[model samples]
Target: LRIRGGAVEAYDGAGGRRHWTHTRAGRRPLAVRPAPGHAFALWSDGLVTDTARTTGRTVHWHRAVPGLSRWLAAGGPGRAAGVLQALDRAARMLAVVTPQRIAAYRTRDGDLRWVLPAEPGCAFDARRTARTGGALLVAQPCGAGASWTAELVAVDDLGRIVPDRTPLRNGPPGDHARARKVVAGDR
Candidate 1:
């Protein structure tokens, strides 16, 4: 499937015959990324479209929505909200991060799963995220001034914080350098 203008088109790979097309009113297409036998599309205004490869049907999830309005209201104007941080196909979760919180949503249906508030004086680095053993690990920089250290947070599949199983600071246990590399966008 491919996104052109405001529509997503599914065409025959062999003969280039158009099979189906879906479009949204008043929205411009931004990107279409491949999922596991599925397609995930994003709009310029933070809207998402989940298109099934087989049926060519689509589900829309506006990232500006649900509880984001509250966050935007509380912060007032000039605060950026509804910014998507990551999409975990394996965990079937979409991580949406704002200045104040990080929220997880079901990728398949756009159901809100959980919301994690940012620690006082610190924010989460969504790019520094990892998935392992049914848990999603996120990194937050601890401390205030010039120097900062990475603090790892482990959230289980059920959206519960796993305190005891949390990995070491600066990265996961046993391989701090590797984790740092990942956080640095080396991999």
Candidate 2:
């Protein structure tokens, strides 16, 4: 995501507590620094048609949004309430799309798993999440045009995509760049 401008905010640990910071005065997703010890996951946000900016001919800018920093706060470093569930199925890994951070976990033993993407912005949150055959099926953003495109992503028991990627367009980015953090869990 082209930050265009930089905006930052401090998040209150309390649920539903709201905070806002000024960016360069525009309607776009501003990159912010997480609490204290957050991590960032770099994955693909999928392709886009450049018909709106730079060239009307349509092309791809950076398929990757700025990596999100999952803060290492008091509760759980890079996690919410120290727990993450993909559709409430005990997520082996949690993906926060709004700010774009990924974290791996193991509950019983406090075993921590971290799957940091080497390639930036290759993953995105889906519109829905479901489980079939022990797989986590998530709708993810795919190609783009004037809208925010998406697709289905299935992570097998091994935590990997099967068909890898499939189209399921949700809508467009409009003027705002996609948020670094997506609402956690299946939509």
**Which candidate comes out best when scored by lDDT?**
1
Runs in model 1 with CA error above 4 Å? Answer: 1-21, 31-33, 60-63, 66-91, 142-150, 164-187
Candidate 2 structure, TM-score to reference: 0.31
Please, what are the lDDT tens digits per residue for candidate 2 over residues 149-170?
2355555323344343332221
lDDT by residue for model 1 over 142-182, one digit each (tens)?
66562443366666434445433332222223534512211
TM-score of each prediction? 0.53, 0.31
Residue 112 of model 2, lDDT score: 32
Residue 187 of model 1 has an lDDT of 60
